[model samples]
Target chain A: MTTTTRGRSDITRLLLTQRIPLLAVLIVVVVVTFFINDAGGYLTASYDFDYMSGSLISAVPLAMLGLAELIVILSGRGGIDLSVGAIVSLSGMIFGFAYGQWGWPLWFAIIATVLFGGLCGAVNGVLVSYIGFPALIATLATFYAFKSIAIVINNQQPISTPPIQELYSLSKSVELPVIGASVPDVPLGIFTFLLPTVVAVWLLLARTAYGRRLYAIGTNDVAARWSGLPVRDTRFKAYVYAGLISGLVAVVTVAQFASARPDAGVSGSGMALPAITIAVLGGVAITGGIGRVAGVVLATLLIVWLNAGILLAFVGNEGSQYQLLALGTVLVFAALLNGLTTRRYGGTV
Target chain B: MTTESLNKNDKTEKNEKSPKRVRVLPAPVTGQEVVLVGVIALLWAGLALSTPAFLTAGSIQPLLVATAPIALIGVGMTIVIITGGIDVSVGGAIMVCSVLTAKTLVGSGVNLGVAVLLSVLTGGVLGLVNGVLIAYGRVHAIIITFGTANLFMFLGLQIFGSGTVNGIPGTLAFFGRGPDGRTLGVPHAFLITVLVTAAAWWYLRHTAGGRHFFAIGGDAQAARLAGVRVQRRVLLAYTTTGLLVGLASCFVIAQGTSTLDQTVGSGKELAVIAAVVIGGTSIMGGRGSVLGTLLGALLVQSVASGVTQLGWRSQLSDLFVGIFIIVAVGADLLRARARRSR
Candidate 1:
């Protein structure tokens, strides 16, 4: 009897403190509901494993940028990067110039683009961490600056050269070689870009001393300074790292689109908001100092699959419109839940 | 009468002897406001010289009309930011208000007053949603507003139904840039914005309730201990922003053509924020003025007009805006540092 009661409490604790488990349950519910709708012939398209797997392509950029925001926000002090979308737009332009306009090798061009994104992020970092600009103002300034440069740099044209067009193969669905028969094929970008980023970010945050320092500063910088941590440098590097990730996302975005569009990142609602939404929904505290890679990854999966289903549920432009509604509702729900969990349990999943 | 004479004598003696102890409100026209005025003057002179048509009524009137919505919203934003919170959903709120009011205008041909009231009420409801969530739920204002921005945008798109709300009536032409929008070469929209801004400036500066917002922003727990209703004040700030947003939407609808599209208020939140920050309002809260916000909006619109008139790429104005933000905020930071050291 005691074991059963203890087990029940353990389950409750897991559901509350661990965002991963809760996200997993939500993902299951979403998938099951979509399946029910599919069975009832209510969907415009089939809601199956193949369609779900195909949709993970969008998660590549979402999760990568989510990680970028996660690191910056983890450094605390009203930390946020409003310029990620702008960085992507600017860096993709540079990538376009290097790979499309110039006759540069693909690997070198990729490195240059990623480094350019890091430079953009570094600018934001120096302004925010060293020069004492507020993060919102600093990033907002750069968001405008980069967005303008991206448009002006190329005279506002997309580069769809031969080599850039070939990059589309990177985002195409690929069948797994060894375990390929039963399961569906997944987008190659998931393996080449997304997995590598997820692993690298996970190892960095989970294993590195810098990550610990970042969290310490985020939780309370004055205390961290008193304890002799290099608070400013740590926070500065977090922005740089976020930029570096944005640089990588630029490459993924370019490959996915099969062309480097000048407004790839800042065209509509912009990529930063969705990335921030993902990070928050993954249970990262907007006030800072608490988040995890697994949580962000799972949250990305949940949103991607849920969006995929929503699209299937509705038709044409209506599908896209409802996607906005779903994203908003889920984000608001998660935020309120974060508040409730923090108040009631003294911690959040 | 003798006690009053005695109190006046005491005040005069205190003012004379303990000058440092005597409280003095800051000057109405601050250094930043003066600098902004000078900069705007320089830009206008330069533009007038470089572009022959810049000083014309055709050129200047539209600029004033365009500046109205942003400056009007900046008044409310100045109050919100002064209270140590932000509302990023204004753009989305604008979309909802404009679309609803546009549809109403297209469908019913509602009179000008009723249309204005409808938009403001819509904005108030949206603002109340944000106020309650932030004040009571205790979520960060940016996150809650961002979520609501999407939701509001969704609501707006749903209202649009098809693609755009076409054939909107011109009942709000008084707020537009045409002859109907002006009297004695002053656009009515700009006139309204100026009057509202002046009123807000007085309310924020001279009133006890206005002082309460600054106290709450400086330190909420301390303000609460000091008998301020911190939550209610915060709620009011957002709601007030909403009411202003509603008014601004009517201006937006009037300024546009007969059709309203989905992109009506895109990136406007950032524009309004840039104006607020440039106006020397502290984003960290507890320090700001609506007067500075008006100057900031004017400077921003001036830059946009200058860039276009110079035949430079229209998008390049954003680069200038970005630079101005850095310079403006950087100057504020330096001044703050000097003050702290002193």
Candidate 2:
């Protein structure tokens, strides 16, 4: 295939692959909505619709987290970020305290939170890149320390988000269309599916010099460093970027849950794996380099869909306990798919 | 390339250099592995003596119990790492196996033999899935195994019906139960661990398949060039580790009730990885030993009991484990550098 065709084909392949996953999730949602409402118009139930909208909204913050780790993995540092969960809890606690008890403005709360996330991520980066600690071990240390720090500050209680009550009341509100009145489709709640940021990340990863640098560094760190790439700086940036994105996740998280739990993302300790699986399934190399943002988005959708579908279909419990099974299956299957792809291509992780 | 061919080429190309006198025989200790292992042992002995309880059997049972699963898991882990792959899903495999035995035997009418066999099967299947992903699916072993860990734990929960299952059939309890009445008066877990370690040592040190793991870990492409069946060895390593973990799970559930919590293996996988690394196994994937892993596990688990028996709270063990892991892993790194330099 010609170069352009290959690029086009890669895009097409990612779309096709992710289409199946997304479709699976969509089908599950549709099926659940249609059938589970055994009660007449249960689909129109206030709580149910609120939950549906709320879930997708909640998913975006996690996707940001998924994206944050995705960028780091794209740099090929072993798809690991042990401090992510802690960072979220820590930074979100800061945001919550500032906005609620401390009375910081909402936008200021976001700015401060994102910066704190970046700072924490930078700390992770320095430890991994400069200090020569293995990504897993260094982050492992930070994981405990960060959470402990947050616990010390928050005293192990969930904190309310300021200005969050507005979003909460809005999320709880059911929009009813009177005979001929049109309601502006659910006033875009704060951080609900921020389209611009996703596009920015996509372009940054796909079309820029820094993006290319990330791919190069990820693909072959030794070669890149030998070739005069700012190895340490690039790495530092990757972790910082992951942290900033995690901060965005923290922000949306506050809005979504309207409460900040210090324990948020404890179960997310192993989350980087699924994120890596999605990135790799979307065609990013685990060793780094040679991937695209489009693929990751697709893979993320696939994972979310498959998981949501499994629950909606009642193939498993529509609860957290069974989510692990669903995620595990997706990851392993994707991994197997990765093996097959590389085997055919004469490559290996 | 054949050694003979390379030797012939080297003679012709380096003929201008000093004549090649009869080569001096290298001492075993001169090898990097021996030197690194020796240094680590020295440091460990020094540390162990500081904690009065670290070396005693009574104080060491907690270590044995904690180390059993990790050591068993590490046995499989060493093979995989030697094959230049890793399986981070032992936690899942162990968790799943622990509960599978419990769920199947407790009030389920299954015989002990069958329940035990099923647990082994559960681990094998989990391993097989991981193996298939690593060997055939072509994903990173670390990642696929990560997912497997999650799936296994989730499956364990689903199959287990949530809360811990208790009152295991008595027959199966021999392996899982304490060594309170054993002839040797040692923790059965410790004995099983030794047996497993010995088996691994024999395999890795004596058997060609074992050598193949090192060959692959050293340089997989070179191993391929040397005509080793890389994929098959990888698969064998994974499956074997899974089997041992199955055994480990039996011991875990045996400790009290056949029932185990889903979190039973939580944080344990990293501990196993740390032990393997501490035991001089390269996380970068080339060298380590069954013996080193045993020592590593002992060192790790002992710290737990040593702290508590010596009167410190048990939570401090995590910090110690982390510190020891850093030191051990760091020592290996320096040793690797020194060896390479020499």
Candidate 3:
């Protein structure tokens, strides 16, 4: 009990110390953007709000990715979802195609996509948990295999459908007062769309006994297993959950855009890897077991802020590949800072 | 590290003996690899038979020229994989080196040798950065290199814009130049690949650090406790990869006299990795050979080359490679499991 309290306080203290720099950066960026773009952009403009909200919405898929990954990482089995992006593309493609071509309902499409993601995730979990394949190689194989499978299924075609305006509005609500009208303030996507997902995820992760064990295993799988936790089941669940959310996110994306492109999330490195970066930058430990939902939220916001800043600043080239470059640079910088602090604390980064 | 040890390992294949015996046994090259090479050779022969143009001494030149960067990269990939590390940033590293070589030609105007040395050094540094993050930061090698890959590619894009370097063309031009159908009808790229292969073979077999790669791959903690400077060796291995990729970048320009776009090497690591595995290097790490990697590269390239000759959709190449990777890994697992049960 003493140890738990001590740890809680320690983390609190660290967060307290770090929060200043984080907020300071946030405020400075806000101020700088406000002044520089002052064609009356705002002491902050509501366009700023929309821009920030857009980043948050963009970050939503990544958050699902990060959370899904965070669970597996916490389970201490040392698993990574290398195929997450492929799965994302595949699930999104399938859901979009079924809804577009077969006229499936939104709920059905959502269920089917999430189920598909779960099945793929289950395959990975089984190979690692049962067949005893190495996590890295196994996931790597699935990563490629899933990609080819998606490509083969769709023949690289985009799954575009007629617009579903009502469904789209679910994720696209905003209340604007507009220079003193009825509404009190500006609105954002998180409040309209992702807040529900966030609340649901928080409840699932924090308010459940399974969540406790999920973290325990992440700290040390062997010990957890020996203590009678269903390491395999829990690990399997982590993948399943990741896949399910990926699927759900895909369906939401399709409905939101009313089109699911084959390249919806087809990057080589995979969204799972970058999501891990976001998670780590958010305060999730790389080695797993310790992290906070709030930290992840803050980190996601930070990423959005950085991206929007780059777009507004127009620093390097116009390609937006530079944004990817900056994103990676920020992640590395965060990691390096982690190493330095850990060393000072006599702790490993 | 030795055939003698290999046979001795096979001798330990008693029913009750640990499956350690199979670890020592020579992994036969796969059909994907063998078939791919056979196809390459057959394509050359068939083309020669079908078209008089194919036999013209200049016909194979393009093929050889194309293989230069791939081969140079194959060598570095062999090292990193042998240590169970994947350096996906090789393409980015090479791109950076390409522009650096070009920049030297343009901005620095250094001699060819110094420019090559400088480019190679830059590669080594990029690799070292990757190694430091992976080994010390405990981040997966893919993510760190992914970050660095982005960093390098962006830097390359910034330093050398999308345009090819004018009439100067930034390519080195000397190392890749060939005599008029001399040197046994092989392109300079082929010759370089062979010489580098020989060097890699000797290095893997002769050096203590070379042996440490396999050990670390086999089991990192065991290697660390075995008094190996595991991190330093990992750093060196990655740096070696960088040097080779850098060499590849230089030769690419030297051969073609053209600059590549930012995405030039973005996803080529997948092919090199697939080639390495098809050639019999375990994706699980700790078990690969220089010769095996060479065979793997040949096999992977054959898939690309042969399909092109056969007029098949090149995009299906991913499917073929993916299927082969799964089969190869599955076979390894089955074999390992069988040996363990015995």
Candidate 4:
């Protein structure tokens, strides 16, 4: 090949193999494009550092769920959890009852809610890992069941007692104790919920034997089984972890909304779609066994920033509609890119 | 040339002959189908005995009409799933189709044939988008459909603009529950669904082309080696589903009042999927029937109607739906396990 061809192939190879660099470049491009649009005096709201930092609030739940999905998809065997959003809604309701109605201590209520979420996930794990049900079918059934119970449990009325209403303070933006004045305040949930989950998941995946076993089973369960690995248990734990994270997210959503809405998780296309989209865009192979924590976090940042920019780019309800268009377009683009890369270079991010 | 060698040759030939005979198409009514029919019948009988008004035409007519759209879409979904693909975008596609058809009727006073044709063609176009991306792009069916579902919803909302499509003319009254919609006490929508389902049943069971879908789903590479044209068949399945979705959108419009809202098809995809899975169709693909899909849709609709008539909370009906799905698939799973053990 000529020198030019060699250089061009080198660039293509880097773009296909190293997903983080590609996502970073895309983020920069998006920011620059929005800045240009803002400079042209076309934005409804200012597109600046302050606005972008404030929009990081959405990223907390998104990144948390994205990490949750990363764990399950990493387990392989067509593994997935469609009921994450439903779990969020159901657990949120339980949290509402404990903290708001029953007036339990916040710490106790939080722990109970998380455990309830894990219990729900265990149901899915048992069905999928032990009972031999397809992950998609098992989660889907639970999605429906949980959603219905969430609604009927409270007769579709959202719980917004005095304690729950006070909990809204948890979602407000807060300044860091040091060097915080130099930057915009970040959503408090980022500190309280998202960061802990991210660090825990990263450590669990990176520095643990369980994580190694998960990757082993996801890569090839039969091979792992032949090697005497606890394949089913590992897979089951992945789902339980996903549900546990979703449960934590339930508290975050309740805090944000100041009430526990029964349909909070399942409204519209639901949280599962966006979370899965983030995982895929973060270079998690839909076929399973390959993904990263940093990649998911970066992908969430890119989307949250892009969406915030789009919200500024348009006025009124049009912005939200266009957000759908943007999300759909980006997802399709990423999915197709995943396919192309897998064929061209024999792998994806 | 001894007796033992001759006996071995005879046994080998017998084994080969038996496989060829057994690989012949499965029976028209499977164990799952019989069980589904029995369950539905028992539910209906119980409802009729407890509630004197359950068997009346006023109640039954609406139930059949409600079932028509789901069963119609379920037929196409049956084919798609058999080919190892799914179309979650059907809900969004229905919204686009119905909203467009309703708007056209209200805006231009179009006749029935033109309206139906317009809806179907639009649905075909949308389905074609999903088919091309999934088939040619080589991505998974679920992801592509999920993406398209959002895109189609955006498109539908853009068309819907301000709000509901109010004051739609009854151009589709022929498919409604009114006297004009029926011939011999059968609503036109349900009748049409039945005829189309029957045709699909025959095509899937008896045709070489239809059997290719099963072959492809069983193993795509093997089917390719067998000259199945897997991609084209998969694309055709989605496109066919789109066409059916278009027609079902019309049924949805007819069943409603003079106005159509933006939430027209919000969760219809799940309902159709529930119906298809309940019909004993394997999600892993390669085994299904349109006849069973029809029966499944009927059973689900009956449950919904029964729950309401029994003065239960309307939302509680979904609980039953969830339970039914578990039971239906669980029974099939047990049967497969039993077969494996045997």
Model 2 chain A: worst 10 consecutive residues (lDDT sum): A42-51
Better of 1 and 3 by TM-score: 1
Fold similarity of candidate 3's chain A to the true chain A, as a TM-score:
0.82
Candidate 1 clash pair list: none
| Error in Å for residue B29 of model 2 | 8.3
lDDT tens digits, residue span A1-349, model 3: 6999999878755644363345346546754664467456532333355565555567767777777766666655456666677778788878876777788886786778889888888877877666766666666667767776776677677766564434565455466546535534333445643576677768877999888888888888789989999877877777777777777667666655656766566664556666777676666665667666666666777766666666665534544556678767877776666566666664332
* Model 4 misplaced regions, further than 4 Å: A2-5, B1-23
Q: For residues B291-325, could you state the per-residue lDDT of candidate 4 as single tens digits?
A: 88998899989999998999987777877888888
Candidate 2 lDDT over B1-342, as tens digits, reads 122333354465676575764332122122334544565466447547776545665555655676777887888888888777888788877878877777667757687678768878878877887887687666678778878887777777777674667666665555643555143656777787899889788777655567778777877788888788988888888998888888877777767554456567776677787777667676656566777787777766766666666666455565566566566666656666787899
Model 1 Cα lDDT, one tens digit per residue, B263-291:
98989999999999999998999888899
lDDT per residue as tens, model 1, A1-349: 6999999988887787778899999999999999999999999888999999999999999999999999999999999999999999999989988998896998999899889888998999999999999999999999999999999888888998999999999999999999988899999999998899999988888899988998899899899999999988999999999999999999999999999998999988999999999999999998789999999999999999999998988877888888888888888888888887788788884
Which ranges in model 1 have alpha carbons more than 4 Å from their true place? A1-13, B1-21
CAPRI category for model 4: medium
Interface RMSD of each: 0.7, 3.2, 2.9, 0.9
Please list all clashing residue pairs in model 2, or write none if there are none. Answer: A339-B137, A339-B138, A340-B137, B176-B254
- Model 1 residue B96 CA deviation (Å) reads 0.7
Per-residue lDDT over A93-132 for candidate 2, one digit per residue giving the tens place of the 0 to 100 score: 8888888778888788889998999998998898778766
Query: Native-vs-model 4 lDDT?
Result: 0.90
Report backbone clashes per prediction.
0, 4, 5, 0
lDDT-better candidate, 3 vs 4: 4
Which whole-number lDDT from 0 to 100 does residue A28 have in model 2? 58
